[model samples]
Target: MELLIKWLSIALSSSVKFFAGPLLGKVYNLPWWQTAICSFLGMMVAVILFSTVARAFFHKYMKGLFNRNERRITPNKRRMVRIWNKFGISGIAFLTPILLTPIGGSIVAISFGTHPMKIIGYMAVSAAFWAIVASIGIYFIPFNFH
Candidate 1:
């Protein structure tokens, strides 16, 4: 029971941020590959949850609101556009895990009118990549953290 709880805690923590599950697994001395898989699953949970909810809300209400309002574009929107033109969806997907939490990344992707499926797919790849990198990277630390 205690072991299950410990794993649940690790998974839940990782769902909020890309690196957290691997960090928790390292602290708990779990095997590296196991840590990577667990961390990836956690991030996927966040990505799926956030992307679906946000996208549904966006399409159902936010889209109508924006269309009705004719709101002027903000500077942030302009910047995002510039980045979008330059980097495109693949770049955003690649960077999301490194630069933003899974929730934040998913929201941003939704805001940009990305398909929810695409967001989750990108997140899956990014989460897996980062999980492996983070888990292995943690193993190389010369100084003991705990």
Candidate 2:
């Protein structure tokens, strides 16, 4: 079904870029609720699975590899750390979906040692909120594709 494929596309999109899912929804002319829910669901699932698995893998193997870079922080990483320090987990989660893809956000959260459940909760809420914003913005843009 087209809807199923569309939903899957939106879900997968969250892993790559912010606003991708919502943009897909607008392009597909999906209802606002469906757009929001699908986007949230996609981000939630991606974050939960990615964070948990990544955490486990990191703890088991990647920890030592990352320790090599502990002495030198990239500028981007320094900025991210500053943001993390200023806003903490909640703020990061709420803003991640807009600032970064679900996967990128999860990676950042994991790097900062945030709990996976909290990341999922915050990202889900963010995804839903952003989806609503995107839908509304697109709807009111005066550009009718119909």
Q: Which candidate number has the best lDDT?
A: 1
lDDT of 2: 0.78
Best prediction by TM-score: 2
Model 2: residues >4 Å from true position, as ranges? Answer: 144-146
lDDT of 1 by residue, 1-146 (tens): 87677677667877887777877887888788888888888888888998998788878887776677567889866765676788866667677767777887887788788888888887788788888898899866654766
**Residue by residue across 1-146, what tens digits does model 2's lDDT show?**
98899988877775577577777887888886777777777788878887899888877887787778558779977878888989987777877876777778888898788888888777777777877787677656777656
Number of clashing residue pairs, candidate 1: 0
Poorest stretch of ten by lDDT in candidate 2: 137-146
Q: Residue 71 CA error for candidate 1 (Å)?
A: 7.2
Q: Which ranges in model 1 have alpha carbons more than 4 Å from their true place? A: 63-79
